[model samples]
Target: MSESQNVIEIKDLDVRYGWGRHSVQVLHGVSLNVAAGCTVGVVGESGSGKSTLAKTLVGTLKPTRGTVMIDGVNVSSVRGADRLKLRRKVLQMIPQDPFSSLNPRHTIGQALAEALDPRHADVKKHRSVIAEWLERVKMPAEAMSRYPHEFSGGQRQRVAIARGLIPEPTVVIADEITSALDVSVQAEILSLIAGLRQELNLTMVFISHNLAVVRQVSDEVAVMYQGKVVEHSPTAELFNNPQHPYTQSLLRAVPGTPGFSIDPGITEHISHENRAIA
Candidate 1:
């Protein structure tokens, strides 16, 4: 949480697609840090570059400008084996929809084995570790042989998590990982992630639009608006005294059930719909 303890650092990051006449920037000089062994949440509304940031961290997207530093190395600049090594050992991603993320043709064991392959000299040697990761993520040993479509959404997510964990990476970037599941399943997955973070001493970059869910998992919260972070605070502080107008509005947009009296003051500085982003 301190400047000297950063495990991941992004400074003046700008991500864009194409170039010249077709260039469209998604991240506007974004910057943040994740301290070692800490969970940092990047929260924002839809189309706010949350997904782009997550993808950049996990090596799926390259920034048009700036750097993504992990363990003091500029990850965005690496190519081929160097980049592959960094991602397999230092970074991993838990995608949003587990149902779609997993390969339908491959069994759970096969999918997990692929993730562990980078560590193993031979893919065949990773079988035992695959079983262990499945157990760690709360999946039954028998479920390893089943295909993704055979399991429920929550179960598939557990398998997806197992795949991500099999590599024993230091940083896990979860992109709305539990957004598609039921509330009960969401809680289960979140608890599993929290437990894993503690047990493994792992650092996590959790990206989501759900403020309540982000509040539950993150030690620090970064409220992003229009592709730039507007506020960064300790989770408790952000929840208690949100300073940014967009952050306040997002909290209000969360639906309340019957018998709940929502505070109307949270929206005083925010528009009915945020219009600041292109």
Candidate 2:
């Protein structure tokens, strides 16, 4: 996509945990560009820095080096009110763990209302809005009075989705929102997100370890390994013609694929090859 079409642009992003001798780098010169009204899947194994990148995009974690530009604003450099404004209006995130993201003390209505932009003229009159969003996520309006524990995992995830979109943000970052659910439930949640994206013309960054799930919702895919994006391409192109050794290993590991197996020896061999290439 052209520069004008890009809604999110990251240049040489680096993230580290701790400081001094204890510091450990998580993202090394990671870069990506996501076009407006498109979905980009960030796929990798655990500790591949996928979640770290998601948090950086949402401004929850500051990058150690590099720039994260969201809709022309440098989120990493913003502070105080500017950061808050960006989070509330320009970007929103649906965390991987829905149960923990929602406070058990708060009712569903209260949780949803908290996410609504306070700048709205009728922010106090958000009951109708909450109900509308609940229904939009395929949940009953009565769910508003219930707490997080009262809902099923899928239902809670739906609530999480509602909360993320309630503010009508320009960008939505979903970090493994369906990983904890059953296969059927996963399909339902993915369908809901796809429908909402169509309706809102949303620009999204979908983070997941499941390549198949990512392929279902993304227009493009970026494959990460050991803190670096080894390959970035259109979803179909990546699947059909993965250029990097790490990308090929990832595809081979997917269940039901041609070489799928539970053999640890095979997995170890792939990992060794990937490390050598890196």
Candidate 3:
């Protein structure tokens, strides 16, 4: 992928946790490209390195080897102010665990304001943007003063989305963001993301174990297995005719017809993966 064209690009990416004797390889030379203003979903079972990839892209977990280019800069090499500059404008991560991701000490609005005014600008300067995002995420502006525990799972996820987008980032990495909510709520969040993508012109990487959810929101889908991208194709093409064994397994596990019941088997598989990650 051309450096100028991609919002985020990973080439021969390898990530390992621990060191020396305890080291375990998590991502094994995985490579992928995310185009500007597109939604690319990464699907895999637990221990498959989905979160590792997301964190690596956002400069949270640096890859032990290979290259991560965010908006044409090699993020793995940049540090301090330079690294912060790259991440602040180019890429952001919406963590899968909203409760942990959100600050319990601060009000929702305060957190949003921090993301909007990272340099400690006057809150008055960014109040309009904060209110706009609150409305966009379907939360009342008054909810800004509320704490994280006061909100339901779906609402917390909305707050997380609002925080990630408040900065108007060019790339968003949503790591299994819909897993915490009920199906109905999941659909609402999906629609919200779709709307935001159009409105913000965002390039998104949505990581999920649910093929159904990925199908609903992603333009292209990449099936990951054992720390590698097994297959990638346009969403419709991949759902209709998956090429990889894991991809076929994932599709077969989806329940009911198109727009029907999400398969229980798929949920079980995802649950299993979560345990592995934990």
Candidate 4:
């Protein structure tokens, strides 16, 4: 996509844990572009730097090198007041676990009210807006009266989604948002996200290890392996004709895929590929 059409543009991203010889590189020259109102699925196994990329987008983890531009603002350059503004308006994230993020001491109403307007004293003033959001997420309006602990995992996830979108952010990064839920709940959550994405024309980066789930949600998919993006293509094209060795191995290892299964050999293949890349 062209620069004007892309809402998020990442270029040659590099992330490291330390300095000098002790430095452990987590991401190596990663680049991705997300068009406005589109979902980009980032699929990779553990340690593929999926979460790291999510963090970089969310500003929780700073990039060691390269540029991250969201809505024309450079993420690394924004600081202090600008940084807070960036978080509230430019980007927001739905975390992997909702229970931990929600406050146990506050009612769902207060939590959402805070999200709506952090300094608004009258929580009741946000009642209508919060109710509308709750309805949008297919939750009961009365759910506002209950505490986070009173909700199930799926219900909590619904609340989390509401909270993330309540701010009307420019971009939302969903990092393993369904990993903690059961299979049925995962389906429900994914469906809800799809509906919401259409309704809001949301620009999102969905990080997941499940290729099937990615295929259902994403218009485009980027396959990550060993901190690098090995392949990026339309969802259908990537699944049907993966060009990278790591990506092909990942597809073949999908459960019930004729003759392949995930095992030590998968890592061996990756190792060989890594050597070849190096």
What would the TM-scores of all predictions be? 0.87, 0.89, 0.88, 0.91
Off by over 4 Å in 3: 1-3, 254-278
Compose the digit string of candidate 3's lDDT tens values, residues 1-278.
45577777889999999999999999999989888887898887777788888888877787888998877789878888887867776678887889998889988888898888778845567778888899999899888778999999989999999999888887888988988787667767777787788888889999987776787779898888889999989999998888888778767664654322345554454445445535
| Candidate 3: pairs in clash | 46-273, 255-263
Model 4, position 127: C-alpha lDDT score: 93
Q: Against the true structure, candidate 2 has what lDDT? A: 0.86
Error of 1 at 8 (Å): 0.6
* CA RMSD of all predictions: 8.0, 8.1, 6.7, 8.5
lDDT of 4 by residue, 1-107 (tens): 78899999999999998789998999999999999998999988888899999988878888999989999999988999999889987899998999999999989
Report how far off residue 51 is in candidate 3 (Å).
1.1
